[model samples]
Target: MSEQSTTDSIVSFVLENKLKTILYTWAAGITGSLAYEWSRPIPGSLKIIHSRVYAQAITLAALGSVAAVEMYQATHHPDKVKKVDKHGY
Candidate 1:
């Protein structure tokens, strides 16, 4: 088999780390929020269930639930995630 290239190795390393994956999306969300603040709303886009305030609330709730799940798994099934030395230097 051919050896993995440097780009492939870096992508695999990042994807294998779960916390880094989630935190990366959170970084993207910050950029998207900044864009939303500067952009005007589209015409005729408002709906009873799809307004900006409602959407933001739902997104926040989803993030909170995911965080809860991560905490629960880390506490009860640490082996399910990558093992790391918390205090190794």
Candidate 2:
């Protein structure tokens, strides 16, 4: 209800949106590579298995890193986040 609390809430919303945009942009960059590999035909069962395993490992690693960094920032320096004003100008 206080002025500072309202400001903080607005800031948090903006920061969350910004982080989502960044993550989505990163995902878009990877989508083409993923689509190409996914469209390919694997010659053997072993190769298919290896590809799936590798993809899973890589996705997990990347997500884990992003989560870790987000957690660290949220816990240690949330105040560093920026909030955009409501005007669309």
Candidate 3:
């Protein structure tokens, strides 16, 4: 209804879709890594597989960090997740 509520709902919808969110993040990272590799003069000097592996590592690290933070919040401050930041918190 309200502008803030509409924005919040859209963000909530995106966050709720775990597979879509993860895939989007992974694809962004992988594409970025591959794009950089393709532009390098010595593309295969470091090995093409290394770029893929590094991209996967970065994706896993990001996902793992978010999961850890979410688990911590669920265990230590579960109520906060349900409450939106109303006063610019």
Best by TM-score: 3
TM-score for candidate 3: 0.56
- Give the per-residue lDDT of model 2 (tens digit) for 1-89: 45656645544554566456445545654564455556777655555565566565656665665566556657767787344478821
Looking at model 2, the pairs that clash are none
Error of 2 at 65 (Å): 0.9
Model 1, 1-89: lDDT tens digits are 99988854644454355456556555555456545644645443443223445446545754665566656656765776555597721
Error of 2 at 43 (Å): 5.3
Q: Lowest summed-lDDT stretch of 10 residues in model 2?
A: 7-16
Worst 10 residues of 1 by lDDT: 42-51
Model 3, range 1-78, lDDT digits (tens) per residue? Answer: 455566445445544564566677778877888778878777475746767787788778767755765566567656
Model 3 C-alpha RMSD vs. true structure (Å) is 8.3
RMSD of each candidate relative to the true structure: 8.5, 10.9, 8.3
What is the total number of backbone clashes in candidate 3?
0
